[model samples]
Target: PGMGEAQAVPYLMGHVPEGVTAGTHYLQAISTGAVFMGAVTYIGNAPNFMVKAIAEEGGVPMPSFFGYMLRFSIPFLVVNFIILSLIFF
Candidate 1:
């Protein structure tokens, strides 16, 4: 769940669930999760760190890790993922 999508896609591709097609819905769901996972943690993706640094340099007061998780990831990203699951998977 934490790994970046570029590296995690292989895991999804390799560990296909029983009865699930490798190239269809299952793969799509896994790919979506992997991509969305970047928003879950500050270190979860490279661009996040870069963006955080840029924001800080520009005088933005960023949240702590856990604060970010609770305020941003949990409230917004997770909800969006749930919606994605309901609509697509």
Candidate 2:
């Protein structure tokens, strides 16, 4: 989320720490929050469009919002969690 970069930059560079950096931290927090929410439901970004287009083309009714998440995003959530933990924690 570029948090490491944002925090490290000022700290390492020894600039005056403006409280404005809180905005950068806030953005990273929001992004992670969105990812968590989107993992449990389909309400973010391009996924809904792609899912709708493919479903329509295949003559399948679009899955319900949470249904889509249960089928697809849960698995991805697991994988993403594993990858992030390995890489960051």
Candidate 3:
């Protein structure tokens, strides 16, 4: 599911039933609880509104769902392979 645009975009474009083009399609993947817990604490999950309130208190502007992941979580995901290699091998 973690695929780069170069690979996934073309495959998805090619598989589009018959008449669709790459320009007409969009794809995105999201991780809900897993990613949410990574950046913020577990408290972030229990009290959703409280998280927002605290962020505002700290002057941290909350990003949109996808925006938050792209800015923060994607970097972690990109380097996760290296982390795995270090741990396992």
Specify the highest-TM-score model's number. Answer: 1
Question: In angstroms, what RMSD does candidate 2 have relative to the true structure?
Answer: 8.9
Candidate 2 residue 58 C-alpha distance from true site, Å: 8.2
Ranking by TM-score: 1, 2, 3
> Worst lDDT window (10 residues) for model 2?
16-25
lDDT of 1: 0.88
lDDT of 2: 0.69
lDDT of each: 0.88, 0.69, 0.57
TM-score quality measure for candidate 2: 0.40
Q: What would the per-residue lDDT of candidate 3 be over residues 2-66, giving only the tens digit for each residue?
A: 88878998988677788655443222113433453454432345565578678978999887667
- Alpha-carbon runs more than 4 Å astray in model 3: 1-44, 47-49, 57-59
Tens-digit lDDT track of model 1 for 1-89 = 58997988888878876787547877798899998887799999988889989999999999888989999999999999999899988
In model 2, what is the error at residue 36, expressed in angstroms? Answer: 4.9
Model 3 has a clash total of 0
Clash totals in order: 0, 0, 0
